[model samples]
Target: MHSPGAIQPAELWRLFMRAMAVVDYARPLELLHVPAADIPAGHAWIRVLACGVCFSDVKIARGQMPFSSSLRLPHIPGHEICGEVLEAPGGFWFQKGDRVLVYNYWGCGRCPMCRIGQENLCLNLQGWVGFTNPGGFQEGLAVPPERLLPLPPGISPEQAAPIGCAIATAYRAVVTRAAVRPGELVGVIGVGGIGLHAVQIARAAGARVIAVDIDPRKLELARVFGAVAVLPEEAEETARRWGDGIGLDAVIETVGHVHTVDLAIRMIRRGGRLIGVGYRLGDMASIHTPRWVLEEITLMGSRYALRHEVEQAIRLVAEGLVRPVIDEVLPLESANEALERLERGQAIGRLVLQVGSFSGV
Candidate 1:
């Protein structure tokens, strides 16, 4: 590890590090030695230990997301990151060898949303870690100290990685956005990575969670996560039946497809809420305007998550209230294979990449 005060920013840039980069659109990531960017003032140099592979990473690699067109070439894309602090500026809360989970997005800090601690909903957006900024597919990262959340003692780097995205996003949707209460009938649409976590979070929040998915494997995993699993064809009916013939009190939509969004809307009872957590770039869902108006149904979109919510998720894992379902953990070199598996819908839960070996502190 380099001493914090010994190396200057320009000198840091002269060093090169290994990374997996997207050099062109719709192409495989190339393993290359790229110049290390300077760790800015007030930031820490994090040695990445693990990174969870999100479907958005796949979408970006395949040029499916709208923002893909604007990304600088050779972009490294793994946002759900876990790492250890290798170096830090003085007076910061974090120090060398401290385990941390990264919050992957940033905002203009002065925006109204940011002022209120909702940086994920910032008006003048800065960048996303894996989207607009260089991300954790590399061995090391330069991250702002405020974005680093300490990993609790019980969580390993691999176990804590997905908390940065999947778990944190689900916690925000179920607990914060939807405000799922005890005894409320909550339906989680699409039992994928984030959806499964939503099921666990809602259940932990004392709600009866009904999980809907087309894949039997995922439905079974949802059952293991404390939800009543059902097929998509049976979701609306199941929710209605469980809600005393009305519908669910809230529906958390993790599959942002048009049909799933439509199904989520239909599964909510009068005065209920539909929280959209998953999304594609241009996909649109049709809503019956009159029906929604008369029934008082609410449609809301949940982006990533708040910073404090990430810490809450870490606590949830620490207390064993929720477990992030990881289908497999592969080496960093297998990122392309991980992406291919996720794109094909073969993964039952979140897939993670072991960036570097780090025993828990």
Candidate 2:
């Protein structure tokens, strides 16, 4: 957050009590200040708790994946976060000190898609926190009140921050997209951040879990998270065997690698589902889909989570049914290092950014 260039704390703080911005290509991820901003009748200004450094953030920083051209420059990149209320605008269930998880995606409130409970696909999506607009990587996040999901008890702020994206995205992959069933066999590809959570959520739903990853360390951790079987990266036979020779009932692909997708598709049974949720780091590679189509294996793509899914994720964590593997919880000052490690695929699990918890961690 240190400014080596035209440092102007006075000017920035005048508009916001404190400002947080991560330079995408040519500026520093900065921290500044400003007088409070106006909260519309259905909105609130929230004090941030913690933010999960997403792979998308790294892509945005490296300019590997481009943002919308319409988006203004000097954009912030955090999209997974949990926080508390700084000020309320009334006419909502929220109150001061209410622990909440921010569903980063906000859409046109009254749109047909939103009315049907598909805000993630709203045509006029207003964008996410810290990406297309202001986000929770700062001391506070000002957003429409509707985007907030009140956190359940027994979940600390820092523990809940990564839940909105990582955990909820996994939930959607299993519960909604994959539609796993009790006593069914489910394969989760890439046992890193998202795959780790996906394994647990699938296991929680009464499925026998098989986790795949290139790293043995991640595979072992997946076992610890209730995975019944841990398969190596190239183990297509492992999946087929686990699927009882017919192929698996469901496979959640969190890795975008083409070879991995091919292996996962080969492991699905007739009428099985495959849920994919990863980005093209650089070159966009395609996976072969003839086997999937021939076998009637369903394929579903999941992105960000909606408010209720995030709420459900919080409850799961608070109840001890699921817990995030915080490989390293460092302060916001060390964000660049965290992002670098994440980009290298060296992180075992979610790398949480302790924004205001500097003194503790």
Candidate 3:
């Protein structure tokens, strides 16, 4: 790989972590060299410094998640990204040598959702950065200039990458979807990467956060994130006690399993809301309709964040209101190991991959 200063003519190397067929586990990501001329117009070339590995990456690698068939073989998988600008088209705002974080969602600009600042829910959705498009697994990527957000000072690229997805998703769940208010009791299920952030964001929103997770360590970590209570086991019993034996005001379900969804349903108050940010493909949860209607339960599915939400999440991290809980930082060569650790339910927070050199930029 060439150094950031050591410039070649116009080509960049990338890891093509593709799976030709369904497998039990995630395979190693392969490397490839993409020519500059091959990149489409209106996109800026960026030198990736760090990219965070998400749990959804594991599901996609195992062929469990439903992806578009249009995506060809040898696909590169990584959404959470922080990089430095290398090249941009004329008249673009971003110049070379700018430190920036790539926004994961790339929606069609003309869509009503995009025009209304809800690009994450664009009616004509194109795809996400790492899922449908070539992602930050590579040393370099070509992204739209509008999708790049300026990285604030004092935050490293590794810390900023996961903000693009993990923290941003949590922000949407707690702040936007759930609309957590002051003095409300919020339950954060699954104290993983997204859940941990949800814990802090809920706390920041003045809600009493009760964290529920099977992992003891994550439950403890949740306390550090300002969770008022922790429930390692008997989530229903503990949540009832925390909510005065009734239920919580809102529940952020990050695990995305049938059980977690069901638990969130049982843990919410009569007029409570359940915001789902996790992806459990092909899994179905049974909800009692009579109770759901009688209780005025609100079930909302929050995808990634919009452009404005990305900026808001970054500001929270910048101001020290919310911290990115990173478990491990590894080189790009250790991508497979990182994915395996995340898949085994061992990661407490986010796992980041240091792809390229973070030099002067």
**Ten-residue stretch with the least lDDT total in model 2:** 1-10
TM-score of 3: 0.90
lDDT of 3 at 291: 85
For candidate 1, which ten residues in a row score worst on lDDT? 7-16
Can you tell me which runs of candidate 2 are displaced by over 4 Å?
1-20, 24-36, 68-70, 228-234, 281-290, 357-361
Query: lDDT per residue, candidate 3, 1-116, as tens digits?
Result: 33445554343233332121222334555545544333468888788889999987876666665764455656677889899887788897888888898987778879888798
TM-score of each: 0.94, 0.88, 0.90
CA-lDDT, candidates in order: 0.88, 0.75, 0.82
User: What's the lDDT for residue 18 in model 1?
Assistant: 67
Clashes of 2: 11
Q: What RMSD value applies to candidate 2?
A: 4.9
- Give the C-alpha lDDT of model 1: 0.88
Query: For model 2, how does the per-residue alpha-carbon lDDT over 1-361 read when each residue is reduced to its tens digit?
Result: 2232433553243244444455556545665553445555667766666888878777666666666445676566687777777567778888777767787888887899888989998888776677777665566667777788887677777678778888889988888888888999998888888889888888889999888877888988988888855555445677678777787888998888777777777777888887888757563545347755666767778877777787788778878888887788877667778778987889988898876532111
- Considering lDDT, where higher is better, how would the candidates rank from best to worst? 1, 3, 2
* lDDT score for residue 161 of model 1: 95
Looking at model 1, residue 232 earns an lDDT score of 86
| Candidate 2 lDDT (Cα, 0 to 1) | 0.75
